[model samples]
Target chain A: METLFYDYVVPCVCAFLACVGFTLMFNIHGMGKLIAGVGGALSWLVYLLAGSTIFAAFLAAVAIGVFAEIMSRVRLCPVTGYVLVALLPLVPGGGIYYAMRHCVAGETQRFLSTLLHTFGMAAALAVGAMLASSVFRAMFPRLRRTGKG
Target chain B: MDYDKLLNMAAELGYQLMYSGAEIYRVEESARRLLYAYGLENPEVFAIPNCVIVSVDTPEGHPITRMRRVPPHGTDIELLERCNGLCRRLCAAPPPIEEAQALIAALPEDEPRYSPRGVLLGYGVAPAFFAPLFGGGLADLVSAFLCGSAVGVCLLYGGRFIGANGFFRTAVSSALASLLAMALVAVGVGESVDVVTISTLMVLVPGVALTNAMREIMAGDTFSGLSRTADAILVASAIALGAAAGQALGGFF
Candidate 1:
């Protein structure tokens, strides 16, 4: 129970707060900010529930992308705002930090391995987000009609 | 309708979209739609990262082209959404050229949506919460909050002077934040300096660039996608380099 509280509940709350911060920093306004925060919280919740792995990060990113799309449609805002803020918690900052630390300490092998891992993680996130957005685009043909007149 | 004014307005719209960090295809699509709604036959719109080019054939069988060099600004989602809504409204109604011009000129200037104090609070709170997500403990959370506030101060103030040079601003702020985190750990304030540093820097990472780059590639804009990918890599490397420099300096002190 303690583990669940620490691992899932705490992070979810933090993620929600962090997402709100990002919404403010990114200059998102109105109720869209709250929806963006929910998008971030949802992503973090999925990430924690899916366990710790590269695949988990990918799935979480996909969840974020899809949620952002829904929010964009509902709120009439750009997806760029919500999607970017929501994915902030999953960015490979820790991996990049460790990679740089290894390089500074002259641990070439460790640096290389860490850098590769970071690259893979970033790639997974990118692919997942791309897939989700692409699916959204395909599903909503009317949304693409920017030339109504 | 004067073709010159119409072309100018369309190009200006594209510039606004690009400046707000909209995707390249989106910019091009918006420009093309605006021109088409304004009675331009077969308007050709091409938007790169830094420039937008639009061309349309006149009644005299001559092609008139207008280009605008849009200076990139920080992502302002409010402005992007407003401009997008304007485009959609224009498309649906095909407003007169004069009305369209007024609408474009009336677009809101970029402004911070929150007060300075609120922004600072957000900066501190975000990293404080992110610390635990990245495996930091209670002590690390407090340390990260402090370090993140320092970064927030640097961004709020240093940005006024160094806002023009994005690379230098990012590097300097990131290095200073990492240095503060390291000092806190050295003073027995945090359990792991690495976790604190990582969590604090999360706000500055290039997650949006990476995701946009992939989406651009999937949308068949390969050149833009590749360039965006390179940009993301460069920014990531800059943050890493700054953190390493900070660690070296901290070790010396």
Candidate 2:
């Protein structure tokens, strides 16, 4: 039980709080903040359960994309802020740092590998979220019955 | 209705949306829909990342064009929401041109904003929690909080000293975060330099740009997407370069 709490619950809570913090910077307020926080936690949980690989980040991005879309429908706002903020945790800051370290330390092989991995991680996130949001909008042709397009 | 007023009003709305970091298609579509609502037979709305251009034909077939050059900006979801809501309302029942223009103009000031201090606190708290996600312990969390705040200070107040250039500003903040993380670990206040540094660096990542860039491409705005993709790459390189410089500087310490 303790291991599960430490491994899953703790990290998910941290992800939630971290996303709430980011909401302040991006000027999201009211229910949008809570929505963004939940989206972030959901993404982190998915990322962890999928095994924290590059593919894991892709799945997480898809989850966030769908989550944000639903929230946007519920609130009738744009999905840009939630998806942008929630995806930050998986953006590979460590990969970039390690790549920089390797490059500076003259480890060409490690630097190249890290750099490529970082690029892959970023690409996966972009494609995953983009695909999910686009497909969702397509499936639900009407954003609003009121013709609020 | 003064067609010139209508043209400028739509352009102004687009400008405000762009300033709030809206998607390019949102800006264009909103402006086009607004003009269409006002009974303009044909309207052309175009926007790149930093500029909004709106052209329309007056009732007499005279062409009127208005352009707004938006400044570099951060995302403000509240303002974006307000502008979008206002646009929808106007489109549903076209308002008087003067009244609509006033509403659009008031958007930037009318929206609520977190004070600078609160935003700085946000900067600190994010990295503090991010440390744990990176497998950091309590001490590393504290170290990250302090280092993140330092980067926040640089971002919020050091603008004049660091210049308004996004690349330089991000680089300086990245360097500051890494250097502070190293110092905190050295002083025995942190467990892992990597975790703390990475957490703080999270604040400087280009994730928003990447997502928005991909979104624009998906929406078929390839020109803006490519430009934003270039921006994301530049910012990433800046972070890498800044961290490298910070580490080298730390070697001397």
Candidate 3:
């Protein structure tokens, strides 16, 4: 368990910094900062423990989505702020960099493989977000629309 | 007074002005000293294109009532033009922070606020790329693109309506752009390479990453934000992956 947690720490830290950077860059609310940090960290942890980025992404998103919905209902933080920050960890930058670098270096076969893997992950991540959201929306019903839930 | 110094001070405080008209009242050295220098007021500053109006409704005992517009930052077509040019130049050249301060000070007054709406649309590579095809129309496209890009970057944070709308809008735009690219190829209007480049690049713009990033930090959900940021990175990677998939599929044809 300790080893597993340690493995996730790196990705968690990366997501945290990215969230902080975004907040500072855009000037978001304080509560928004907290929610985003928690969401991003948890999602990365899920990925590390499960070794499945898609599943991890889904779990994190759903968790954030549910939390945001509840918080908003209670008249606390804004739901959008929380969800937006929490989604940062799933962008796929490394894949693009790897593929582009390989392609530029003339490693055609490797580039193709890496490129496909990157796309697969990307598609999976989007589906995960959609699924998480849809599930939450179904459960809460109010969370689907903007004003009521 | 040094115009540049004034602008520099405001920017440092993260007070970027938006819009301007004309000054209604003048608070000379005494008012300036009390207001600007002493900072004895929590004024609500409303900005237009080239004007700034501040209402002195603080310190119930301070005898100052009504609103006033101060032109410490000048507003003329030339000034507006200069500021616009400066905005672009600074975005491109990115001078030292101190130098930027100086330029702002020299300008004499706030030009307007810098809104990020246009920036997101620019990344789409072309405006009206999906106006005719998408059900939501131009406004919808703009709103979605802006909201998605903002949410993606952690900019404005969330509102499920914005996210849902943004997702649907972007997907439609993506499909529309894709179709256009394909059509262009069919008509021989552009080379296959051009079609691929245009269509694929549009998909790579990371709206989710930006939005989530900001919300995570501001909400104090550092741990969660970190996870989401990773997810965002994965999403961006996936877009490139999608592009590659399309590329490979094209090759088979």
Candidate 4:
């Protein structure tokens, strides 16, 4: 129970709150902001459930993109506003830091590997978001036709 | 509407979207759609990180063009959403040119939803939660909270002097944050400095830029994609550089 709480529940809540903070920092408003926070939590939940791998980040970002698309349709806002903040927790901050630190410490091999890993994670996130968004864009011709989105 | 004014207004709209961090395709499409709705049949719109260009063939067969150099501004999703909403509404029922111009001019002045204090509180508390997610314990959480607050204060103040230079602001704030986190760990106030540092630095990371860069590339805007990717790389390197410098300085102290 403790492990579950610490490992999942707490982190998910933190991710949600952190995304809320991010949305505020970016000056996001209204129902979209609240939903964006939920998207953040959901993405983090997906990340955790997928075993927190680079692939997990990709899958989580796709989930976030899909959620943001639905929210965009419902809230009548751009998906950029929602997806930008929601994907924060899965970004490769640690990987980039370690890669740079390794480079600075003269560990060339470790630096290369970490740098590549960070790049891969970033690529995964981007590809996932794009795929989901494009899929939704294709699926929702009605929304586009009405010019409501 | 006069062709020059219409072209100018369309470009202005694109500039606003770009300034608010809308993706390249969105900016281009919004400008194009708005132009088409307003009776400019052959509108050409192009946008990048730093500039937007709109050109349309006038009734006289001459091309009227307008361009705006958008200064870098922080992302404000509310403003982007509002502007997008404005575009949709205008497209649905084309507004008068004067009304459209007024709306475009009014976009930047929209007030933020959260007070400064609320934003600061977010900055302070977010990293505390982030620490646990990064495998931090109780002590790391507390330290991350403190460090994140310091980062927030730095941002609130440093942001003013730094202006729109994202690279310098990120480097300065990240270095100070890393130093503070390292000092806390050195004094045994935090368990793992790595977790605390990473959590605190999460706010400054360029995840959005990187993600958007890929999306742009996949959408066939290769130039914009590459430019945004370079930007993300530069920001990441700046943070990494700042943290390294802080660690080296901390060792000396």
Candidate 5:
């Protein structure tokens, strides 16, 4: 239980709070803020459950995409804010930092590896979220139109 | 109906959408749909990342094109939702051009905005929480909060001093965050320099650009997508470079 709390619950709560902070900076008003925060927690939880690999980030992005789409449909707002904010935790800041440290320390081999991994993680996230959003939209076209209406 | 007025209005709407960081296709599609609602059959609408162009015929074989250059902008979801809503309403009813224009003009005025203090609180709170995600303990979280707040002050209030260049500004903020994190850790306030620095750097990451770039590519706007992809890479490099400079500066301690 302690392990689960440390590994899953704490991180997701942090993610949720972090995304709420982002919503303020992005000026997401009204119900959109809560939706974005929940999306963030959901994505982080998914990422943790999927084992925190590049593929995990991909799965997390897919989760965020679908969740954001559903939230947008329910709220009748655009999905941009939720997806963007929720995906922040998975954007490879650590990879970039490690890469920079390696580069600065003259470890060219390590730097290159870290840089490529960072790129891979980012690509995985973008592609995953986009694919999920597109599939969701295709699957529920009439529903989306009704929501838009 | 004055075609010239209509042309300007549609182009202006597109401009507002782009400024609010709507996707490329959304801008083009919204303008095109608005023109269609106004009974124009062949309106040509095109938008790149920084520019929007709309052309319409005045029913007498005369063509009028209006192009607006969008300035560099941060994403404003409130404004974007408002623009989307107004666009839909305009398309639904084909409001009088002047009235629509008035509505569009009113968008930025009455939209919600957080106070500067609140935005600063956001900048601090996000990194503070991010530190825990990065394996920081309570001390590191407080350290990250301070570093994040200092960088936030630099970004929110030091625009003129930092220069208007996005790359330079990001670099400066990253450097400040890292340097402050290192200073705090050195002074025994933080457990891990790595955790606080990385946490502070999270706010400066190019996640928005990356996601928007992918969305553009998925929507078949390869031009905008490529440009945004390049932007994301640039900002990432800027953060990397800036953090390195700050760490190097902190290495003296």
Candidate 6:
């Protein structure tokens, strides 16, 4: 567990940066930084736990969307602000880099697969937010009552 | 209802708002109040710095709203400072909504509501890079990298308007920024830029935001939170493209 934490440190920090950056970008108010940081970490955890990287990516995105809504309600911070941070853990920077590297190396098959993987990950993350929100509504009767409550 | 509080909120989030953009001022004020009242934070706006400012009167049988001119470009450091001052005042004596509405209605017709187009977009992108800093692992890094690429694709066309350059130029610029970022990472200097700063900087590229924005726009509202989301996606895509270009260059050696 200790080793896992140490290994995960880099991604968590990146997630934190993503969250803070989102808050700064959108000018979210009151606890924006904190919300983003926690949200990013949570998203990263989702990614880590899921069996497949793609599934994990999707779960993280959805988690962020739902969590953002929850933060907006519970913390009185901006949902978009939280979403921005939460989604940070899924940006796909390394995948793109890998794909490009392969492409330059004349490894066309590897490059294409990586490219597909990169975009697929993004799509999953983007749609995941909407799906998570729906699932939350289904599970929590109280949430549906307030219409974003 | 507390304009100063709203302004402070905007400032804290790094929104470059103009004092003269009263319509946006009103919208932002309303958003601030409503978000608090409804218990929602960072609710996306339909349009920023609304082009029109309206004053509704119910003196007759039916209430009607009248909008007047609120000029743009009056936003200055002075106004930002005033907002800071006002935030302090509001903290001391928060006003009622009715009073707040009246105050909003009383603002000079010449005041325009102006907001920097992508300020929120920029702020939104930080988490992708920052997650790793907080103990997120290779999974998180993978997420950031992929998300960055999608962001690059989104920015291919949308950035020209923001940068006032052509789409190709914007696309190339996005590629360039990512290239620079990759170089930083490859030479063992990625530590200096750090994951958070890189994500924050890339978030402004409109990569992820663009996808959300298009979806929202298609649903109905032109300037909704979703649209801002699309802008975010494109920005991210641009950054990723640049990074990919740089990585490819590095792999050559």
Interface DockQ per candidate: 0.69, 0.82, 0.04, 0.72, 0.67, 0.29
TM-score of chain A of 1: 0.90
Candidate 3 lDDT score at position A137: 61
**TM-score of the second chain, cand. 1:** 0.92
- What is candidate 2's lDDT per residue for A18-123, written digit by digit as tens? 9999998999999999998988899999999999999999999999999999988988888888998899989999999999989988999999999999999999
Off by over 4 Å in 6: A8-10, A76-78, A100-107, A138-149, B1-163, B166-211, B214-237, B240-253
Specify the highest-DockQ model's number.
Answer: 2
Enumerate residue pairs that collide in model 5.
none
Q: Is candidate 1 or candidate 2 better by lDDT?
A: 2
The sequence of per-residue lDDT tens digits that candidate 6 reaches over residues B1-253 is 3433443343332232223222233344543443354233343332343233222222243333323232323223223323433433443454664554344333333233223434333333443455354333454454444445444434434455545443344455445445544554556534433352244334433434533443344335556544355445554555456555544554575
> Scored by Cα lDDT, where does model 2 land?
0.92
Per-residue CA lDDT of candidate 2, range B1-253, in tens? 7898999899999999999999999999999999989988879999999999999877677887888999999989999999989989899988799999998899898789999999999999999999999999999999999998999899999988999999999999998888998899999999998999999999999999999999999999999999999999999999999988887888799
Predicted complex 3: CAPRI docking category: incorrect
**Model 1 residue B209 CA deviation in Å:** 1.2
Clashes of each: 0, 0, 96, 0, 0, 123
Tell me how large the interface RMSD of candidate 5 is.
Answer: 2.0
Candidates ranked, most accurate by TM-score first = 2, 5, 4, 1, 6, 3
Q: Which segments of model 1 are wrong by more than 4 Å?
A: A143-149, B110-112, B160-163
Error of 2 at B24 (Å): 0.5
Query: lDDT by residue for model 1 over A10-52, one digit each (tens)?
Result: 8888888888877767778888778878888888888877886
**How big is the positional error of residue A38 in model 2, measured in Å on the Cα after superposition?**
0.8
**Deviation (Å) of B48 in candidate 5:** 0.7
Ranking by lDDT: 2, 5, 4, 1, 6, 3
Which candidate gets the maximum TM-score versus the true structure? 2
Per-model TM-score, in order, reads: 0.94, 0.98, 0.38, 0.94, 0.98, 0.54
Candidate 4 Cα misplacement greater than 4 A, ranges: B159-164
lDDT of each: 0.84, 0.92, 0.43, 0.85, 0.91, 0.49
Best by lDDT: 2
Candidate 4 residue-wise lDDT, B30-145, digit = tens: 99999889877779988878889888997788887788998867787877877888898888898788888888888878646677788887787778778988889989989998
Pairs that clash in candidate 4: none
lDDT of 1 by residue, B1-253 (tens): 6998888899889988888788888899988988888777899999777889999899998899999997757677887888898998998888788889778767765444688877888888889889988888989989988988888888887777767576676777779879999899999999898889998888778887887788789879999999889988988888988888888889898
